[model samples]
Target: MYGFEIEGGFTFYKFRDFDGSLSLSDDHLKWFWEKMGKAGQISVVFYDGSVESFEDFKKLAKLKDQHFFLGFKDGRPAGMFWLNGFTQRSCFVHLTIIPDFHGKAALQMGRGVLRHLLSVTDVSGSYILDCVKGLIPVMNSLACRMAQRSGFEKAGVIQKAVYLAAEDKSVDAAIFCAVRNNEVKVSE
Candidate 1:
């Protein structure tokens, strides 16, 4: 089990049985992709208007700028959390929770991951996440709401920020962000 105490002395735990293991190794890359594909959920859309295949996803995950983690629940693949375009100031967070673990469980796991990111990593600026408005409900809406509950606030909307293959068009995205210091206001 892994754990950390966030602000206010609240401790969060990522158990091997409940929250599963999180790792950046290639050993679980394929397994993670398989689980994501099976969920019929596409967490990200490339700029080229193509959804990444398992191979391409693995390659992208292996990139130096990206941090990928696969979570296993009860010794099986359960969820994934990724940080793309990481820099000293900020990064984009992408999360996917298999349908089987959707709802409250997914929200708990997501909060745990976000708390870990904020408290454990060297990321002291901000953490941002974008989600296509239309897909929010179907694609883990609870997790999106949990972000706000965890101190992230809605920043703004980006028109045509993502290409949805299923719809064959670009869609508006809702941007949310959490800043490390309360003094730094999110720009309008």
Candidate 2:
């Protein structure tokens, strides 16, 4: 894992701040919110098409779950990503790689993060990833593909669930579940 390298000749450093409150500051929070608007890696649309304040980000970060932030070589806040429902059984994520590092070494950091999430986090059964059908770029990342390569199948699509973002706009989303439990598989 230490020998892994990314496209821009940069190596990934694991940020252990799972609580998401360590490196964050007023300025950094503001930066995350501002950057969210132009972040191409994110598919979910924001209420105002802009993340102009850190309050919203802080709230999101406050969720009691496992989170990870990937940093670049120069350490200039390349990207911010995290996961929810992180438990010994399974975990989920709302990831974004930030636009600037879309095709650079920062992407490697994102992949590494996902790999860590899968390897370290004990998904009691197997790691499950939920993604929207329209967000192909995200679903096609190395992490998701790796899960498929590992024999994780498309369990099913989440049919019911209306996500209400800011402004009370309910959004429709699809969910994908993967179970790596041999016992469950054999039972089925």
Best by lDDT: 1
Put down candidate 1 lDDT per residue, 1-188, tens digits, no spaces: 44444332233333222223343345567776667667766544333334467768766765566556666666576666666655555677766766776666665566566656654532564343322111222233554465565445777667776566666777776677765545222121
**Root-mean-square deviation of every model:** 7.7, 7.7
Off by over 4 Å in 1: 1-27, 43-49, 121-143, 149-151, 183-188
Any residue pairs clashing in model 1, and if so which?
none
**Poorly placed runs, candidate 2 (over 4 Å):** 1-21, 39-52, 66-70, 104-107, 121-153, 164-172, 177-188
Writing each residue's lDDT as its tens digit, candidate 2 over 24-118 gives: 44555556556665563233433333433456566655555545454445555565555556455565554555556655344455445444444
In angstroms, how far off is 2's CA in candidate 2?
15
TM-score of 2: 0.55
Question: Looking at candidate 2, what is the lDDT of residue 113?
Answer: 48
Specify the poorest-scoring 10-residue window by lDDT in model 2.
130-139
Q: 40, model 1: CA deviation in Å?
A: 1.1
Listed in order, each prediction's TM-score against the native is 0.66, 0.55
| lDDT: worst 10-residue window of model 1 | 129-138
